[model samples]
Target: MRFQRSAVLCLLALLAIPAAAISQTMDYDRLDARLTRLAADEDMVGLSVAVIEDGRIAFAKGYGVTEIGGEPVTDDTVFRWASLSKGVAATEIAILASQARLNITDTVGSFKTSLRLPGGGEQRATLEDVLSHRLGILPNAYDTRLEDGWDPAKIRESLKSLKPVCAIGECHTYQNVAYDSIAEVVEDVTESKYADAVQRSVFVPLGMATASIGRSGLQNSPSWARPYSKRGRTAGRPKEKIVNDNYYRIPAAGGVNGSIRDLALYARAHMGLVPDVLGETALDLLQTPRIYTRREQARMSSRYRGTVRDARYGLGWRIYKYGEAGNRVVGHRGAVEGYRSFILFDPDRDTGVVILWNSSSRQPNGIGFEVMDMAYGLPFHDWMELDTSQAAAGH
Candidate 1:
């Protein structure tokens, strides 16, 4: 009897998919079939996705397996949100500032002691710079080195070393070291660990019970999904090596575990669900364009070519004015080894989406785009997450 029970358990384990390819409606059935076929071809362990429409789940489903060696993704499968974690940080900043706990105008020099920008540019860096990637702080990638006594002084050392390629707002260099510096600020202001502040301000308020700030010592919950990459998605092992990559430094810019559904709830709230979460006033301030990246403006999607309008960059988001068809969309995408994710929303339509994928995402929702369109707007997801927002009322 024990042997039979173990066999049953094993069979059930093999059935896990991170977010299934099965979307919930006939309109999405075509994409559902394609995702089903790709789940096999790509060899994706699992993927879980959801679309927020008219304030409810238009569609939500899981697919494939959870980890390469695990079960399939279910509605509950947890995924590492990667850079999508920025929105969580942005949410905290909004809440704190709304309560007058901190000021967005506070300078980096004010927070971190003993260091100055290589050319003294940081003296001018305000809180807005840290949150918006506008501060010409260090331009390294995920380079946070948190020691036991890591203090404001060391952060200054990090900032003083950045090679200012240009003036503070001149170049929009998407950076992790700079944002992690903001994480340090979050710690200082809240008098809480960065992770703790994130939990209190964003995770808990949104009722995302599964969300976690840092690594856990506890055993893997049944919902935890393994990470996967594009190479691994195609004929490689379903579970790739968990490495000394993205999670090790655990910068504020990254490091949050979540599910597609949970993230959508968080995203939907940005559309004024209860501005009490961040306060409508503070939410408005965070979305304004503080720095515009010339790099992004000069480039156009290959698909759009010559006809593309110069894209714009806001404080924590990419700002743009699309045609009537484009006005309804906004959000961001995140990627790391063995995992990739997308979170976009249609503020005008009160819609949002979270795509928690264990394998490579050929985004703006490659195989996933079709189903995504049915829920919100279209495929216009861009990189850069710090809670990207659309035109909200009054700053």
Candidate 2:
């Protein structure tokens, strides 16, 4: 009896070791499969995802239908990175600033004399304030009109009519006004348009052969996925909403389009792999937190949970805690009319992930959620694990 008990105990111990080891290794495939299940949801159209591990793209894949009833999104699909453009534009501005070509803290009145703003009739804000959401203009999740639609012109127009909710550096309010001013600043200083700057400063250097801030017409250009809206809606926009489909006019704010791989390449650029479009010092300056936004706490908690410690907003990127001692993790997400996008990297680890979905409404930002989770291999108890445990129970 004693011998039999010992044999059984040894066998159990042996099994326990492997189970413990298995537990340590997260099931990313199952997590991805669970993400795949999201396709069965109501509005998701298509998605492309790339995971960068240790400074290089380790895996890139796409799923779901690119069009409502068309082919599944392949790795080649391009998506509009709405607010994500803020990061790129901010980076561009920062690069220019570092070269003494631009300054975030400079007054907008000096950039364009024709441009009139509302705050104090002559209130000035910095490039950092605008892109980092610290201008304190509004949209502290309060105003409805400022939340959506095409209003770059109106935002620019309102400058002379609006008042600074707080002092120049008092608080952070993520809005379009500062970014628009930055776009104008880019053109004013560079003597070149934002698109022209991107063409010369970034796109060309990265060899982004097909990327552009072209209008909605180009959203469907070669090597791109067709733009889409939430289900039961349009692809581009209500014909009335489009003012100048060419967002480059305000590209410094939110006008960019490119492929998942290309965007990943852009993220890679931030990690110092590609030639310095903005140079190493310029990129370094961008990672520095200009604003510590408690406003983003709730949203970051909801999306990233424990992964995002208190974060600071860089010129355009969201800086999060990366290492055990709160090392900074920098990345950005873009949301256009129909497409949604996210690109982030851990500069210390030289690792990042970029995911772009052709349709923004249906799939939502879950792609960014899952990719970030998987990138760090954060142990999570999501539905996927529940389903896996259940299946194991059955066996």
The best candidate in terms of lDDT: 2
Highest-TM-score candidate: 2
User: What tens-digit string does per-residue lDDT give for candidate 1 at 82-160?
Assistant: 7877766777777888888878887767774344566766678776766677655445432445323244346556566
| Candidate 2 per-residue lDDT over residues 122-213, each given as its tens digit | 34655566667665555522223344443555645655556657766677777654466677777778887678887788877876665778
Query: 120, model 1: CA deviation in Å?
Result: 3.3
Compared with the true structure, the alpha-carbon lDDT of candidate 1 equals 0.59
TM for candidate 1 is 0.77
Q: lDDT per prediction?
A: 0.59, 0.62
In candidate 2, how many Å is residue 58 off?
A: 1.2
